[model samples]
Target: MVQTVKLMKNRLAMYGLVWVLAMVAMACSSDDGDDNAGSREVKFEVTGNFTGQLNAVLITASGGGTSESINALPWSKTITYESNVPTTQISIAGAGGDPGETITVKVIVGGKEKSSTPGTATNSGTIAVAAPSYAF
Candidate 1:
């Protein structure tokens, strides 16, 4: 199935990103959990700079079911952000099982802002994507 192959590719890309984020989180001693349903609190390797350059990578899930699509999210959509918390959330809008399976939250940043500086990693509510002013 062509669609299946495409889904696999997308999953791989997202996994790679999450792996990088996990390593960074370990270095900072931050919490990680599946915000949608798992309670994961991953530490992001981004320093505190509210210049509006940081963006949250929001991932909504998709699967088979009756009331599919939670949060009224479009089929597999991604949202951009401008400075927010180091953590983002991902999950199927209304799949009724759990949040997005497999490393859901990850960074869309090309590089780590902390790699260049020691004692890096910022903690602010700016990385949140569930705000009213958030872009979908």
Candidate 2:
């Protein structure tokens, strides 16, 4: 009986020692130096120019070229544009959202429906936002 009691006490001590060692290791191995302390990452930017009244414009994207889906885009608007003068001061909010994604821009001039020819987006590609974040 005493032997069994001693065995149990030894096991208890070993367990306590292991627990203490584990705690110490965890504390010492922690990120003692702020790994990401001062490092900064770059956002995305989406820039483009479209002529015509720009009846409507849609910005799209895809990630890893998988789904081929239009990741982030805008809706259609009912605005009339002039003939000679092209649209100016055009900027999208969430085009530069996620990186490594495919982007597509669609614009309709005169007629309705998605069948309208889509205008080129100046190859903004994966837009990188560098300022205040805008939620869509």
Candidate 3:
């Protein structure tokens, strides 16, 4: 009888060990796909016409509770920005050419772009803001 009881206790201990290992595996195998839950990177592509002494373009990005201004870009450049929010408002403006001499501007974000059609950069003119979708 004592031998039978010892064998039962060994079996019970083995079962407990297996149950604990199963629980650990189950806990370690859950992944909800939110690896970037805190921050994400966004890219900006700025391109425009900088002619006749206009060598720089002013780029501004604001939104997601923050604001940034890049005041001197070489008319065509890419900017990488990091943010926790997935949408940002960007703008470009310039002035240095003759009257009606235009400076076409476009901003690319999240692989999407928005252009300022007929963006006129007259002696004292500007352009509006462009908002694009982003992802994290």
Candidate 4:
């Protein structure tokens, strides 16, 4: 009878261990369908010698997932996109420069300024900053 009890105790201990490991495995398993899985907030800031020349700026990120226009100078817009998004686009519009005249454009992402490149005012004095790679 003592031997049987001892065997039963050993089985109980083994069962307890198995139960703990199973619980741990369940805890470690990730639910890929989480709503916040790829979520992140990205900020785009438009600034420059806008002065009276700057009228409105268009910003788009994540393939139109987030887009808006700023009708004021030194404007900023914050948007959220998946961390996997590759790039974003910006466009600046104004009424001061000549058609097709070169204008300076500045962009800031995540509170840090991005490098400037040559942008030209359109026939309507609009300029585009195409597909800048998004920073994760």
Candidate 5:
């Protein structure tokens, strides 16, 4: 009888282990068909009548990366990102331009303008503009 009880206990432990493993596997599995299910088209544009070359021009790209341009007026960038984050930031900065020059930054998502901001160069010829945070 003692041997039978030991065998039963071992079987019960094995069954419990199997159940736990099954639960873990199910928990780890994804119900969504694809990990990159939803994607967004993001575009950043900078336009202005700033005279002279723009220095240190910086623009944000998808995946929180940035790209720089020099003397590139009316610059724009587009990216497609499958992001889980609810919001993304878009901005632009330039220096060494003519004083009192004007600059405008825009953030477009899915071909719709989401945010726009205007900036002017300081007396030292520096300007920075940022669009409102884009919500997906």
Candidate 6:
């Protein structure tokens, strides 16, 4: 009778171990369909008929930081990030160009234009433009 009881206890322990391992395997498995589901492509652009170079250009980068560029005309920057990003911004200030020349700042997301703003150069031959912040 003692031998039979020992065999039953061993079987019970083995069953418990198997159950625990199955639970662990299920917990470690991933059920989500796509790992890149929230990924997005973002682009910032400056364009128009402004003659000279663009200055004081500020753009929001993929890592949620501002980047500056000087003497960049017809400028564009593209980055990829997750959709959880809160906001993105772009701006150009006091660009020296022909008076009355036009300039536009734009934010594009996922191949679509999210925001655009246009400005005209002042008589002093400078233009400043800023696009509205884009929210994911």
Best by lDDT: 6
List the RMSD of every prediction in angstroms. 16.8, 27.0, 28.1, 27.1, 23.8, 26.7
TM-scores for the candidates: 0.21, 0.23, 0.37, 0.41, 0.60, 0.60
Over 34-75, each residue of candidate 3 has an lDDT whose tens digit, in order, gives 544333333444444444332222222322222233344434
lDDT of 5 by residue, 18-124 (tens): 44333333343221333333436767788888764443222223333333443566878776655653445544555456789998888676666666889998897
The reply for model 3, stretches above 4 Å from the true place, is: 1-42, 50-74, 110-118, 123-136
Best model per TM-score? 5
> Which tens-of-lDDT digit does each residue in 21-40 have in candidate 6?
34333333221234432336
Candidate 4 per-residue lDDT over residues 1-136, each given as its tens digit: 6776445444533443444333333343232344433334545556544432443223234433222334554566676655554444444444444666654444445444454545666665445443243333
lDDT of 2 by residue, 18-98 (tens): 443333333322112334322222122222332211111111121011101122243333333233222211122222223
Residues 1-136, candidate 1: write the lDDT tens digits.
6776445445534553454344334433233222332222222222232232222323222211111112221122233322433333332111112222211222322222111221212243112221111111
Regions of candidate 5 where Cα sits further than 4 Å from its true position: 1-39, 52-62
Of 2 and 5, the candidate ahead on TM-score is 5
**Weakest ten-residue segment in model 5 by summed lDDT:** 55-64
How large an RMSD does model 1 have?
A: 16.8
Clashes of each: 20, 13, 0, 1, 0, 0
Clashing pairs in 6: none
Rank order by lDDT, top first? 6, 5, 4, 3, 1, 2
Task: Go through the candidates in order and give each one's C-alpha lDDT.
Answer: 0.27, 0.26, 0.38, 0.45, 0.56, 0.57
Give me the runs in candidate 1 sitting further than 4 Å from their true place: 28-136
Q: Which segments of model 4 are wrong by more than 4 Å?
A: 1-40, 49-67, 94-104, 118-126
